[model samples]
Target: MIRRRAFLATCGALGAALLSRRAIAATAEVLASLRSARQRIRTLQARFEQERTLGLLATRVVSRGELTVVLPGQLRWELLPPDSITWWITPAGLAYASSRSRASADRSAAGPMAGVLDDVLVVLGGDPTRLEPRYALEAALQPDETVRVVATPKDSRISAVMRSIEILIDRDLISPRRIRMEESSSDRIEIRFSDVRINQPVDPARMRPPTEPRP
Candidate 1:
């Protein structure tokens, strides 16, 4: 169960990675700018490719997925191809649906994921200031005008699961282009987003796990 908590926490960190890629000095002004930029966002939809490289694995494992986030607290991430799985974090609780099964099930209230579910949900909600209190932030400008932001966790709970997160943002577009998360165990996960749509109306149903009987 400890392993599961770590796994989900790492996965949830992906969403907030984009929040850090501001090309500016690490100062109050920079933090304010970041907050203002992300605050403009209300709804977001994007497709992402997550590549996980583990210390024990000789090759990277890649997964493609699409995610939808609706402000304060609703999110849905669906992994496609090789296997289909959907994870939903909503007002009610956390739930998941697997293609291999017919029912959408809710996570146990005291489950391992319970501890970090809010962390994941908040990241997906695109709140830039949400992580401010927990990480020491730094940003540098690139030759291409892209900003690289690095965030080191200040909280042991977060640092225990991962080392740090690095993000590259396209300054002109004011959007994140790449994110790399480093883990303590020498595992690395990189997520790249494409076809990003912001402030768009996403189907509410998409944020809810499917309700159907197991067949």
Candidate 2:
């Protein structure tokens, strides 16, 4: 009877150890995945073809851009070909869009994107530490075996411009596949990445403008 009791006790101890190992493994996976994701984001540049679909028709607003991102909160959205515009996010609010004439009218506007700011900052900046207060975050399954994150803004006006923002990260690499911005009126801005480079040399002049046109 004592032997049986001791055997059962051993079994219980074994089960507990197995469970503890699984929990530790899960933690390690989470940490490894997050680290891989941050590293992938460190060197990312893509050429994007933006299409703005207004209610009835799909209009091709073609813009080929190179994005250079530096760490937790620096990004440059440069539009080349068909037109020229740059959306800069220096964590403050730095952006310049071609005005009416491309040469004579670059006006200042209001909102998060107007200056050195971007919605991605909400997540890439401090969301890791304080996710709840800044965004309503959720995850969904994707066909490509990726887990996608949908972020709804806590900021008022920006939320109006965007219903929700989605970031699709690879199952393995954990790097972003696409950044999709859904507008309130069912319009969407989808930026998919290809030919991505990480942690490469970036010229400061790439973020600099040739001329500032004041309207």
Best by lDDT: 1
**lDDT for residue 59 in candidate 2, whole number 0-100:** 57
lDDT of each: 0.69, 0.58
Q: Write the per-residue lDDT of candidate 1 for residues 1-215, one digit (tens) a residue.
A: 99999989987786466454332335445545555667777887889999989877667889999978887777887889775888877766677788676444355653444434455444443554566787776766678867666777787877777677777766643466677888756698898988878888887667766762333
RMSD of 1: 12.6
Once superposed on the true structure, which residue ranges of model 1 sit more than 4 Å away at CA?
Answer: 1-25, 101-125, 172-174, 211-215
**What TM-score would candidate 2 get against the native?**
0.64
Model 2: runs farther than 4 Å from truth?
1-32, 39-41, 56-60, 97-109, 112-117, 121-131, 140-144, 172-174, 209-215
Error of 1 at 50 (Å): 1.5
| TM-score quality measure for candidate 1 | 0.72
